[model samples]
Every structure is written in structure tokens, then in C-alpha cells.
Target chain A: MVVIAHPAIAEDSMPRATLRAILGMRLQRWPGETPVKVFVLADETPEHATFSKSVLQVFPQQLRMAWDRQVFSGQGQYPEVIASTQEMLARVASTPGAIGYVKASEVTPNVRVLKIR
Target chain B: MCVCSRFAKTTASIALAGCLLSWHTASHALDLLDGDFQLHGFASLTLVSTTDNNLFGQSDNQISKDFSEVGVNASWRLTPALQLSGGLLSRRAGGTDDGGVRLDYGLLDWAPMSSEGGRAGIRMGRIKTAYGLYNTTRDVPFTRPSIILPQSIYFERTRNLTVSADGAEVYVERFGEGGTLSASFAYGQPQTDTEAAKVPLVGLDRPGKLDSKLAPDLQILYEGAGNSYRLAFTALRLDLKYQPGYRDILQAGRFRLTPLIFSAQYNAENWSLTSEYALRRTSISDFGPYFYNGTFNGQSYYVQGTYRLTPQWEALLRYDAFYADQNDRDGKDFAAATRLPGFTRFAKDWTVGLRFDVTPQFMLRAEAHFVDGTGFLAAQDNPNPQALRRYWDNFMLQASFRF
Candidate 1:
């Protein structure tokens, strides 16, 4: 798995905690204080499960429940879920402050790969 | 009776309208706001039937459709460190609530200190109480494990008092590779003066109303092993005063309640186990000679399990118990003094339920309950405690939608 972020993000690397917070929607802004827009594959997808377990080290359903609790309680919003890795890559590359993950083989040139600090 | 059903129909129609509105808004609401803003809402309509006493209306042998819940909430990230949020909620649960729209929560959250290691913040306004694992989002159907929450701890009879309070809260969170630790402290005035709050705190026939003092609540939560294991502790103190009306048979009295709760949960891919234990200390004094004046400790707990049959389907089983007085667990002594049935002092309930997520935005659920004792039933619904049956069963169905 390769973690990629829009170029607007200040850090070229991130700690796992910060990454979890961002993916968990607890942290809304990047280091530069720019709004952080998160994108992800559908929860049921193999890519989503793989990325959540390996990169985020969390269960996909846990993330979904967290999102549901937040969204229904008006405390947070759900990350935009894409249907395919192609769409995930395309959106992460185009959208500012976007962050997502893809298979290492599918990593493209448009997005910056973030190192795990 | 006909009028109540007519009103129920009206609320159901409003819920349907809310459903359509949320669907429309979910797709476009974010685009309309600054990139930092979002809109979300949910609606649920429940049909309940009971083998005995009424619950959410005349549920005795007849399907009662009066239970409905609808809410809309919005949040805006005004800045990277500050956010503003609010919600409007309308609940129609038989005679307990009026089904009128009320401000659920309106608050400004400011994080003065934040980092990758830990963060601290304050929220000011009407804030939801951090009672247990589920109190903050208790009104939302999707967030709840069953159509109705475990009544042992989340007592609907006294719900208004703990639902939301108008005041301020401070929260701190620490993030680590091992787990996340979070704590919050809140001081606010509970929403009293409602029948739901009054009937349980005071007597159903009280001549006066209940007024609350500033309540203090504190809770700590730990999520370990990548959110698979959770533990929590909560403590809350409430003080209420009864103001008698002119020439009233009752005298002004004071009641104080302090509750401590211990909660734990274990989550796996296919199944989850959850449980919470609460000890409540209650004191009543200065009600002249006609009322019961004493202090006692109450106990409540529930053990529940949920299994995912598939991605879209789930099953739930729970056994919940409540005792009004720990010392008088059987209630015989209290019953002799008060002339109330001993069964009124305790309740044990067994529940089985199923849920189906028709889609990401909509869901359906059905639940059946076998209950013994009348401890948790609302006095307003029972009217005469002597008339309540010691054993009863209930069946309910609900459809909920959210965006």
C-alpha cells in the first residue's frame, strides 16, 4: 500500500497517529492549516479493507461505525467514498488537501507519496 | 384516542418529508456551504405493541405508531481550530414528549491546544451529556444497537434530565499507537419541568414542578487495540427542587442523585459484546411529613451481544436489570411502608432483535422484549402503579433513514 496526498499538504511524511486521526475525521486540517479532504474506497471493497488494516492498522467496520456515530451526531462528516482505485487516484490527485491510499503498483505520478514518519 | 392517532399520522408524514429532504440535501448540501460545512439528518418511525401496559401509547394488543424521532444537524469548521454546530430534534414518544421541535445542541468548539500527541478543547452552549457509551447519540436510530436502547441505564422516563444540558464542557484527548484516551467534564442545567423528567423525579400527581441546579458530569473513555476493546467510566451529580403551588398538598422538597457507571465493550469482525454497570445514589429530604424522606443506592446493568450475520444484516440479544434500592433489593420493606407492589422496585428484561441495512442511507429493525417488574415504566403511562402487570411482553418495528 502507498499513502498519497495532494501536494498542498505540508508534510511529506506523517506519524501513524496523525494519519489515523485524519482518516478517522478527527483532524480536519493539514499541517499548513489547509482543509484536509479525505477520500477512500467503499468499505466492502478489498482495497479498502487492505488499506485500513495494513496502513491504518484498524478495522474497516470500526471506521464505518465511527463515521456513522459522528455524522449522525453532527460531530463529523463522512469521507468521500469512491467506487474504484482509478477514481480514488484521480480524485486524490485533483483535489486539494486530499489524502488516500492505493496499491503500490497503482501509485501514479500526479500524487505525492507520503512516508510513514 | 382518535385525535392522538391523527397526530401520529401527521408526525409520520413529517418524518417522511424529512426523509426526502435529507436525501436531497445530502447530495448537494456540502456543495452549497464553504468546503468546511456539512449537513446531516435522520428520521425513524416505530410501531409498538405490548401484551400488557402501554408503551409509547396504547401499545396493549394494538400497534401504536406514535413513537417517532427526527433530527437535523449542521456543523461548520469556522477555522482549523474552531467549529460551530447545532441540531434540531423532534421526538414523539407517546405522552413522554410533545413531538415539538426543540434545539438539540448548539455549541462552539474551540481547541486552544492541539497536536499529534494530545488535544484539549472547550464547547459552550447546549451540549449533550457524556453519560455512557451511547448517550451523546442516543436519539439517532442508526447509532443505537437496538430499536430502543437498554432501559436499564438509559431510562426514558427520566431522559429529559440527562438528554442535553445548557452550559459548557471541556474535553481532552490523547492519541497513541496503543490506544486513545479521552475525558470530558461538563457543568450544565438539566432540562427539567417536563413530564418525562417530573414523573420519575417527583410523584406523578405532584402539584408542583421540578427545577434543577447546575449539574456536573464527567466521563473517561479508553479505546485500545485499534478500537476493538473499549472501557469507560462516568460520574454525574444532579440536584433538583420541587416548588409547590398555592395551597398544594405537597411541600417543597429537594432531591439529589449521583450516578457512577462502568462500561466495557469488546468488538470483533463478526461479533461484539457490550456491558455497563451503574450505581445511583439518591437522597430526598424536607418534603414535610407526607412524603418518603430517605437516601438509598440503586443499581442497574446490562449485558448485550451483537452478531453480524452478513454485511447488511445483524442480530442482537440483551439481558438488562434494574433495582431501585440496593439495600432493599426485593423491595418488600419499602413496599410495606409505601403500600406499593414489591415488583415496582425492580425490573429484569430480556430482548432479541434483528436489523437490516437496506442501503447505506436506510435501515429496518424489529425487536421483542420480555420484561418482569414495573421499575422502568413511566408513571405517566401506567397512571396507577397498582394496575401494572408484573410480567409483560412487547414487540416493535421501526424504519429509519439518514443522510
Candidate 2:
């Protein structure tokens, strides 16, 4: 899976910790203070699990638990769950400050691929 | 009493309907202000039955629907560094808690410092107390491992005093390759005026009032390997003063409680293991000769394991134990002195349960507990001491929904 972001974002690469914070729903804004809108596939999907495990280096359950703790406690919100990689691509391509993951083969020019160092 | 019951019945029906409806539809958080403002909520209903003693109402040999939880919360990120959030809850927990709309938490959180490494923040207002792992969101059914939390440390009788407090908290967190670390310190006034809070401490309503000084609570936690392992420690202290009532037999007195807790957990791909241990020191003074005036150390712990048979189904097993006074683990001396049952002061419980996620938004669970004592029974629910039983079994079923 490749991390995809809006084409408008300035940085083409990010630290893995910063990526984790973004997907963990902790980092609420980007460098320019653009509210970061996170998107993901349903937890039960293979793409979602692979992205969470191999890409983000966290378990899908961990992400779910974290989101539950934050959402229920009024600390944060859940990432918008997309139905498919096609939808994930479209959402990331259209939404400014949006971040998501899709299969490497499915990456399109409309979205920017973020390299995790 | 009649009014309360009617209200409970009404909400129960509505919550039941809500759960049923949720199974057929997919839901998400309601977003406004360009998704910066969000609203979310959950509702749950539980049915409980016991063998030999009343619990969460008169559930002896009959099912009682006296336990339920419903809540709604909203948060707005006024700016990246500032957020305003609040939650409203209506919880029904038998004789201990009436289903009344109450503010669960309302706070303003400010984080002026942030970086790739970590961030620091301060929260002010009525904030949820960070006790053990689960205290912060114990009311949310979807977050609990069982229908009822471990009674040993998370006692329902005095939950009002430990659930939330009005004050301020400062927190710092760090994110590194090794793991994530966070710590928080809070100074707040716990609610002590409720009957639920008083009955557990004084053993009766006593017609007097209980007031508490500002309490201090601290917790530090670390999550390693992406939450594959988690460890935490917590310390809390409360000091309370009691005023005698009209023609009261007791004199003005003071009470102090200090508790230290250790928690650890390991999460695997398909299974998880968790445990917590607590030491509590309590003392009462100036209450005159009739009441107990000395200090006693209490102990409680629990170990639990959960396995996911499939993504949609899970199973649980746990052993929980509590000793009101470690020195009197069996309560023999106290029983002889007060003429109460020896087993009333301690409890050991074994539990097993199953959960089925019918959908992401709806869940169903069933659990059974074999308890060896009535240590945590609410005095208000079982007013007569003689009616208490040493050995009992409890069964519970719950349906929960969230959006």
C-alpha cells in the first residue's frame, strides 16, 4: 500500500512518526495549519489491514482501539472510512489536506504519493 | 421512586429500539463546520440475573433490566491547538445510579506546544478522572470487555467519587521509535455528596453531608511496539470531611483514601492479555468511639484474557479478587465485631463471556460470573445485612449500539 495525500500538500515525504500521528488521528493539522482529514478503508478489509500492519507498523485493532478511546472520550474523531480503493483514490484526490492509503498498483496521478522515511 | 422507574422504563424502550434500528443501517459521526465539529453517541441495554442476592435491582432468580447507558458527545476544534468538548450521559445502574441526564465531561483543552516528537497540553473544566485503564470511558459499552467491569477496583458503589472531577489537568506525551509515553497530573474536587458515594464510605446515608478537599491524581503510561505491549501506573489521594446530622450519634470526622494502581497489557494479532493490581490505604479519624477510626490497607487485582475466534466473534475469561482489608482478608474480625457476615468484606469472582459483532455499529454479548462473596454489593440495593449471601452466580446479556 502507498500513502496518498492531496496533490496540493507541499511536502512529498514525511517522517514515519509523523505519518503514524496522522493516521492515528492525533495530528490534527498540517504545517500550514490545514485541518488534516484522514481517510481509510474499513478495518475488516485486506487493504486496510495491510496498510495498518506493513505501512503504518500498527495493528488494525490498535488503530480501532485508539480511535474508540479518542472518539468516545471526546479527544478526537474517527477517520473517514472509504468503501474501496477507487473511492479512497477519489476522496484523497478531491479533498484538500486529506491523507489515505491505497494499493500501490492503484495509485493515480490525481493524488500525491507520500514517501515515509 | 415511581417517577424514576417510569423514566427508566421509557428510556429502556427507546434504547432497545435504537439498538434494533442500528443493526440495519451504517452510521458515522455527524460532521459540521467542515468536519471540525463532530457529534457522536452510543446506547446500550443490559439484562442481569443473580442466584441468591439482589444486584442492580431485585434480580434474584429473575431477569432485571435496571442497567443501561446512553450518551452523546460533541467536540469542536476551534483551532488546531484548541478544542471544546462535552458529553451528556444518562446511566441506570440499579439502586446505585438513577438514569438522570448528567454531564459526563465538559472541558477546554489547550495544547500550545507540539512537534514531531510530542506535545504538551492542559485541560480545564469537569474532566474524567484517569484512574486505571478503563475509568476514563467506563460508561461506553462498546469500550468495555464485559457487561460489567471488574468490581474489585472499579466499584460501582462509589463510582460518583471516582468517575470525574471538576478541576484542571496537565499532560505531556512523547512519540519515539521505541514507543509512546504519556503522563498526566490532575488536581480536582471529586463529587462526594451523592448517596452512592456516601453509602460505600460511611456504610449508610447517615443524613449528613460529605465534602472532599481538592484531590490529586497522577498516571504515567507507555505503549511499546505499536501497542503490542502497554504498561501504566497511577496514584490518587482523596481527603473528605463529614458533618454530623441532627441528633447524629457520630461526631464530625475526617476520612482519607490513597490508592496506587499498576496496569499492564499485551496485545497480539488475535488475542490479548491484561492485568491490574491496586493497593488502597484508608483511614478515618475523630468519629468518636462508635465508628472504626483506624487505618487499613486494601488489595485488589484481576487477570483477564481475550481471544478472537474470528473477526466477528470473541471470547473472554477473567479472575478477579478483592480484599477490603488485606490484614483481614477473610473479614473474620470485622464480622465478629459488627455481627455481619464474614464474606461481606472480600470477594473472588470467576467470569467467562462471549461477544458477537453483528455489525460494526451493533454488538451483542453474554457473560456469567461465579462469585465467592458479596464484598462489592451496594448497601442501598441490599439494605438488610442478614439477606446477604456468601456464594452467588450472576448472568448478564447486553446489546450495544454506537454512531
Query: Top lDDT: which candidate number?
Result: 2
lDDT digits (tens) for residues A12-117 of candidate 1: 8888887888888877777566777888888878888998988888889888888877665556677877778889889888988899999999988889999876
Candidate 1 lDDT tens digits, B246-320:
777768999999999999999998899999999999999988877778999999999999999998999999999
Candidate 2's DockQ is: 0.63
Q: Please, what is the TM-score per model?
A: 0.95, 0.95
Docking class of 2: medium
Best model per DockQ: 2
Ten-residue region with minimum lDDT total, candidate 1 chain A: A68-77
Interface RMSD of predicted model 2: 1.4
Q: Output the lDDT of residue B56, model 1.
A: 88
What is the iRMSD of the candidate numbered 1? 1.8
Colliding pairs, model 2: none
Q: What is the C-alpha lDDT of each candidate?
A: 0.86, 0.87
